[model samples]
Each structure stands twice: as structure tokens, then as C-alpha cells.
Target: MASDFDDPGYDYAVSVAGRAVRTMAEQRIPPMPTNFAIWFQYYAGSHNNLRNAIDLLIDHNRPFDVSTNQDLFETCIAPEVSAVVVETSERLQA
Candidate 1:
């Protein structure tokens, strides 16, 4: 029997992460945590709005400047981060 660590899903996730990092380097986006989270979600195809926003920006040839990255993080990743924080706090309190 194969170990859980050998699951194909793990490989897929690694592939997505690699693509995210490569795309970030190509776009000159910083390898900051928030930026990586945003790009990871984009490459994972799990967040449509985030993907659409990024696609629009790329389509328009917009630079991923600090402001643009900040906007993307706020719009795309902050809500998920807030939810995780809230869940963790509740779990700890429980």
C-alpha cells in the first residue's frame, strides 16, 4: 500500500505551487507570503474571482506593483485569512 505522502494529490499541489512561484517570478511579484498565497490560489484554480482579477491585469499588461499586490491580497486572500484566524481562535477558546 502506498503511503499518504505518495498520493497524487500531493504531486498536483506541488505542481501548482511550482507554477505559482514561476509565474510570480515572471511577473516580478515579490515572493512575500501574501503574494504567494494569492498566486497559489490563482494557479490552483480554486478562486475564480482571484483568477479573473489576475487574468484581467495580465490581459491589460498591468504591472504587479506594490499597490496592485496589496489590492489583490486585500480583495482575494484577506477574507480567507480572517476566517482561518477566527476558526483558530474559536477552537482555542473551546
Candidate 2:
């Protein structure tokens, strides 16, 4: 059985973050933590569930591409995420 902490994504995330930092340095982008975070989040796209879904597909030997990308977005990603424009709004309302 696979544990959440052992997810292959941790390695992928580290690699991407390192690349982000290096790329910024090479291009002379500001070395601020905020800038690094912005680039990292852009790397993840707007969808919060995207990385997890792709990880699942890759782990199962499923083909992930443009066609399947739309399928996953519509069928899984959109539905799974909350509709809140501001997630904290719920807390404020309560």
C-alpha cells in the first residue's frame, strides 16, 4: 500500500521548485520568496487538483495528454473543488 507521504509528487515538486529558483536566477528575476511562490503556483496551473490527478494517471499507467486533460478537468477537477469564490467567506458567514 502506498502512503501519502511517500507519494512520488514530493520529488517532482522539489525538482520543479529548484528549477524555478534556478530559472529565476538565470533570468535575473527577483529572488524574493513571493516571486518564487508565484512562479511555482503558475507551474501548478490554477487547478488545485491537477497534479494529484496526473500523478494518479501516471501511477496507473494511464496515458495523459491534451484529450485526457480536458476529460479530467471537466469530469474530476471541477467537480471535486469547492465553488467558493473566497473560501474564507464560509467562515465569515458562519
Candidate 3:
């Protein structure tokens, strides 16, 4: 749980949904609305396995370099596609 997640440019919604979309690609899952819903639900779950890693990082109170942002996203959120979920969640979070 390093402060890397606290980057000044960080957008929580973008990070979450961006990962979902990247997960879709990595899993070869189509980016349909229904599928997106499933991915987002899992990301948002209180006991989410993926997010748990993030929680653990925070619990450790570690510090990460800004250069590790992609690693943070892939390891905690999704993969290395992009950093903006510029569609639905973007609008919703806004």
C-alpha cells in the first residue's frame, strides 16, 4: 500500500475500470456491456481478490516509485494497456 497509488494524476475510477478493460483483453473476453458490468462488479466487491492485493500493499505501508505506475496497475488493477477508463466509468465517476 505505497503512496504510488496516490499519484497526483491518479483517478480512482480510471484506474479501476482501466484495469477491467485490460483484463478483458488479456482474458480474451469481449468488451460487451454485460461483461464490463461483471468486471466492474468484481473490482468493486468488498472482498475482491484483485483489490485485496492493493489493500495488502497499503497495509504494508510501502513506498513505490512513480515509474512503477504500470506495474501497480497491472498487479493491482489490470495490465499495461492504458490508464484511462474513458467510457462508462469515466462518465459515472465524473
Candidate 4:
């Protein structure tokens, strides 16, 4: 199993989440949560499946919320859009 951070094809948003989590851990700063590492792991294992998951989330009219444990009203919603960039990159690669 590849380390979550080391996976080359890992989703970009997921990778950002990983970095956010790491920053939170190392600097004691709050990060955008939402099981991003799980997303990373999933992307590493299967890009297409991850894409489908992203698509389903998009089709349902969601905000791609990443804040699992933060103030709902305080979190920035646009950063969440990065998930699209990540998924699109992966699909392009495929």
C-alpha cells in the first residue's frame, strides 16, 4: 500500500486535504476535513471509481463540503471546488 501523500495519481483535492490535515497535526491549525485521506486512498486504488463517486456527488446538487468538524458557517465553500480540478485531472489522465 502506498503512503497517502506519496501516491502520484492521488486526487488533487484529496492531496490538498492531506496537506491540510498534516498542517492541522503539525501546526495545530484546523484543516478542511471530510475523510480526505479516504478519498486519497480510494483514488490511488481506482481512479475511475473515484470519478464516478465525484460525478454522483455533483449530479445531486451538493456543495462538496469538506468540513467534518468545523463551524459550518465559517468554512469557505469555494475551496471545496478544488475537488473538481482534482477529479478532472485524473479523468484527463485516464
Candidate 5:
């Protein structure tokens, strides 16, 4: 799969993700879609999560796209995410 994006191959990531999304779209199993939604929601924390989710979806024979995971971690947080308090305060003042 890694080789798909490099020499001897190109857009392998896109291909894999596309296949995963297609597989998931055609799934007929119960609790499977629910499980997928739950995991997908949890992985929305970062771009890596998106990539990992795509990988998981592909491994499970579903369709997905790596770009869908883009900018997953672009948010700027404080050293401990405590900066939210300050951000909220500033927003309120504005």
C-alpha cells in the first residue's frame, strides 16, 4: 500500500481510501456501521486519526480518502489545552 503512493505506483493512498469508502457504503451488517461511526467520531481528534481511520476502513474493505483526514490537528491549544479558557474569555469580551 505504501508503494502505491511512490515508485511503481501513484495515488495508492487515494485508491485504498476510495475502496474502503465504497465497501463501507455497501455494508449490510448490523452494528457494523454503528461501530464505524463511533470509531470515526473518536478519531476526529487529529489528521493522523483520519489516516488511521482510512487504514482501518480499507483493512475492513470500506471506501475512504486520505484528504478527508487533512487539517485534523491544525488547532492551536495551550500547553495543556487550558488555553481554551483564555480563548473563550477573549471571545466573550469581543
Candidate 6:
């Protein structure tokens, strides 16, 4: 059977990954999973709130310190992570 997933292929994936890493380095954000997720989403244009929040921070010359990263992850990514966990749990139970 054919897959439904729309794979962006290896090259596109590599480009996005590179951009994510570069962004993290530029912002001095650690290469933690949550931080990478934020940047990847930002470059991918997947999450507008995250993109806007980071942009606003940049505009204000605010540092992406630990507290800021935590806040952004919780506000933007935690809910999605929670939903995925719940869905995976349900599937496993079934």
C-alpha cells in the first residue's frame, strides 16, 4: 500500500535541519530537543505564534535565555507533544 505521508525528501529535510541548527547557533539557544523543535517549526513556517514570538524577541534584542526558551516551548510545543503522547497511548491501549 502507498503511504499517505508527504515526504519532503532527503535534501529538503537536510536543508531544514541545517537552518534549524544555524538559527539555534545564532540565537545562542542550546541544541536541546525542545529548542531545536522551536527553530525547526519557525523555519518550516509551521507555527506562526512561535515564529512571531521569536521575531518579537529579535526585534527587541531580547536574549533567548533558559527561561525564555522554556516559556516558548511550553506555550507553543507542549500542547502538541501532549496530544501526540495521548494519541500514542490510546493506540497502544487499543
The true-versus-predicted C-alpha distance at residue 69 of model 2, in Å, is: 29
For all predicted structures, in order, the TM-scores are 0.85, 0.39, 0.38, 0.27, 0.22, 0.83
Best by TM-score: 1
Over 1-94, each residue of candidate 4 has an lDDT whose tens digit, in order, gives: 2223443644765675566466346534343344444344334444454446555645885444444323221232223345556766888999
Q: State in Å the error of residue 63, model 6.
A: 0.8
Model 3: which ten-residue window has the lowest total lDDT? 1-10
lDDT of each: 0.84, 0.54, 0.51, 0.45, 0.40, 0.82
Report the Cα RMSD per candidate: 5.7, 10.5, 14.4, 13.7, 12.8, 3.8
Per-residue accuracy of model 5 over 28-62 as CA lDDT, tens digit each: 32234333433333333333444565566669875
Q: Give the per-residue lDDT of model 1 (tens digit) for 21-58.
A: 99989988889998988887888787789999999999
TM-score of 2: 0.39
lDDT: worst 10-residue window of model 6: 1-10
Residue 59 CA error for candidate 1 (Å)?
1.1
- In candidate 2, stretches whose alpha carbon ends up further than 4 angstroms from where it belongs are 1-8, 45-85, 89-94
- Candidate 6's TM-score: 0.83
The window of 10 residues in a row where model 4 has the poorest summed lDDT is 69-78
Model 3 lDDT, full chain set:
0.51
| Candidate that would win on lDDT | 1
List, residue by residue over 49-86, the lDDT tens digit for candidate 6. 88899999999999999999999999988887777778
Task: Estimate the lDDT of model 1.
Answer: 0.84
**What is the descending lDDT order?**
1, 6, 2, 3, 4, 5
Clashing pairs for predicted structure model 6, backbone only: none
State, as a TM-score between 0 and 1, how close model 3 is to the true structure.
0.38
